[model samples]
Target chain A: MISIHNLTKQFGRLRALDGIEAEFSAGQSIALIGPNGSGKTTLLKCLLGMARPDNGTLQFEGSDLTRSDTYRARIGYMPQIGRYPDNMRIGQLFDMMRDLRGYPENVDEELLDEFGLKAMFDKPLRALSGGTRQKVSAALAFLFRPAVLILDEPTAGLDPLAAEVLKAKILRERNTDRVIIVTSHILSDLDEISTHVLYLMDGKLQFFKDIETLKTETGESRLGLAIANVMRRHANENQASA
Target chain B: MLAKYSSTAAATLPFTGEPDGVTCAEKKARPVAAMLKIAKYVLYDILRNRIVLGYAAFLFVAALTFFNLEGDGSKSLMSLLNIVLIVAPLVSVIFSTIHFYNSYEFIELLVAQPVSRRTILGAEYAGVGGALVAAFLFGIGLPVAVFAPDARGFTLLVVGVLLTLVFVSLAFLAAVLTRDKARGIGLALLLWFCFSILYDGLVLVLLFAFSDYPLEKPTLVLTFLNPVDLSRILMLLQLDVSALMGYTGAVFNEFLGSTLGVALAYGCLALWVLLPMIWAERVFRKKDL
Candidate 1:
């Protein structure tokens, strides 16, 4: 579980995350959707301690994550664009991550096997295509069976079959009550896995609602159309005064 | 089998279902292990780089050529000093800067790991600093040790190592300051240029402008300011070339002629390495990946 309070981050004159307050609980499969430059990645980075917020606090299970590294052990994060050491082989990279985590007692390798990363052990990360790299990222995220999973665009670069496998894994984890936060642009990709939706626009939390609640309220069954209708209303309201 | 056991345990134990991170906290990854692991990877990556290999080869050839060209070993040591002064810092600074910028993705991935930010940064500094030092020692120091085994040769080696550390630390600082890779590299080169070239030119002007006054203290201060100048003075003293050093060298000789002065010179060199290191660590702690 993670709790954020009044979180704010700014890059030069541009504010990336503004006064964000949110919570993530176990068993909640959250789909974090936002337009470009709306601070989705930045928010995820702040949570992972890659980006430090200017104001407010983020805690894992009531203790400040910024204060300790041990708290991070429970989190498995997948960056939208996974960047690894170019020269390192995929096998060595996995070995190093496992070594860094101190050889956890149990590591879930479903995605790793399903994605067939084991066969590409000799391939250097530089030689791997973008989709292959995404497969690697997805595998690592699920490797630990982490209490919290922060996945940024987890399926963006995966093949259709690989994407389906990942979706199935997400659904299985949701039933097991593991916390998985995903940020994705593809509505259909999210519709099956995510139970809740948190939409962000211009660094603000436009709304947070259950997927079914959102669909029912918007009078649209499709997640993408429901979200579009909501955005359309927001745009119309803002444009009316302008 | 292990997965099945874990699944069964999770199902049977209500405590495992609790959201508290402390209950089933991972075996903490020791900071030392984290640091060493990262350093190991960084060293492996750098050693294989064509640039680092080229750098080491260049040093070997330069040292070999100079040693053979000058019939007398001491004469060659003098030439080696100048070369080491110019080449070591240039190569170390630029190489470290580029390595830091190029490893951006690696750094990002590491940042999200369970390891602490301190471990991440400490490991990075150790990694880069260690790799470049290795390059310098093998490429440059080995030849010097073989050719000139005296204290003077050893002094040159120490100076070379110190310069490498100083420049690498400065590169870390430069990399941390700006987000753009090109700008960061530019800033690093500019820093190298200022210390190696511009700093010397300005010091010369200051010495000339105040030629009439007793500039001993000021010149001494000035020499102490730039690491390159300090290194030059140390090298000159060791090579027994006080006559070519002119007035400032004499001033340095008077001050650094004693054991205390020698200690102070090394202390300053160590400080040069330390100041940038501390600055870089501070920047790294707060740096956005």
Candidate 2:
């Protein structure tokens, strides 16, 4: 479980994450939805301690996130664009990660088998296609059987079947005491796996609610339409206030 | 609870042979062990790079050509010294800057893991610096040992190795100071230029402008400021070329030519290697990857 308080990150004049606050508890698959440049990635980066927050505190399991990196042992992150050493083989990359994590025998490898990545284990990372690279990232994220999985645009470049495979894996993994935070533009994909929705607009938290409550309030069964309905209401409210 | 879920899923989907004993608590090695692990991978990557291999081959051939053409050990050493002073630092700077930029995404990936920033940057410094040092030793050191094998030849090899590390550190500093690849590389080149060429030009102007005064100490301090100059002076003193350098040369020969002076010069070069890397590490720790 993680808690963020008054998280603010400023990039020059643009406020990427403006005094945002949220809490994510275990067994909650959070769908972090936001438009482009809406501080979605920045928020995730702050949580991962990849980007230092201009002002705020992040706590994981009652411990300060920025104080030590041992907390990351529980986190498995799949970057939006996974960049790897060009000449390293897929197998070598996985081997190196396993070695670094010191968990050679405890890896999941479910996504690896499902995606059939083992067949191309010898191929250099630079030779992999975009979808294949996505598969690699997904597999690595799930490899450690981590308590928290932060995936950024995980299904963006996947094929339909691969996307379905990843979704099914997410669903299966969600049953455990794990917190899966996924950021993707595809609402239907999230609808299948996510239990909670955390929406952001202009670096501010628009809402953080359960999917059922969001559905009932918007009177829309599908998440895409429900979020669209909420956006429309917000836009009208803003215009009237102005 | 995790085992129960995995077992339930296992009934439908075949499980990989891994046991159902996955725990949230991870076992990690000590910081140095982790640093070495990352450094090993980085070293392997650099050793396999075509550009780096080509650089090694180029140095070997250049050393061989110089030795064969000169036919005299000291003359060949002087030629190789120029290569060490100019070409070695340039290659180290450019290659290291490019390598850092190319591995930007890889660094991001590593940062997301359980590793500390110190481990990542330290591994980079060790790996790149190690590979370049090995290349210099292999390409130039081997030939000099075979053809000359004198104290001056030995000093040349030491200077070459230290210069490589010094420039690599400078390159990392440049890379960390900027987000843009072009800018990083430009800054690296500018640093190389300042140390190798501009610094010498400024020293010459100072010597001419201060010809009326006893400028030996200031010029000696200026030489220590530039690793390239420190290396050249270190090697030239060993080559016994102070007679060609005039009165200041006699001063340098008297000062840098002694045991304490040599130790001080090497210490200055070592500082050149450490200071930039330490500064770069500080910048990289809080850097937004």
Error of 2 at B112 (Å): 1.2
Lowest lDDT block of 10, candidate 1 chain B: B2-11
In model 2, the Cα lDDT at residue B186 comes to 99
lDDT of candidate 1 over B111-130, digit per residue (tens): 78766666776788788888
Pairing residues by index, what is the TM-score of model 1?
A: 0.91
| Chain A of model 1 scored by TM-score | 0.96
Per-residue CA lDDT of candidate 2, range A200-240, in tens? Answer: 99999999999999999999999999999999999999999
Clashing pairs in 2: none
Range of the 10 consecutive residues with the lowest summed lDDT in candidate 2 chain A: A63-72
Give the DockQ of candidate 1.
0.45
At residue A218, give the lDDT of candidate 1: 95
Docking class of 1: acceptable
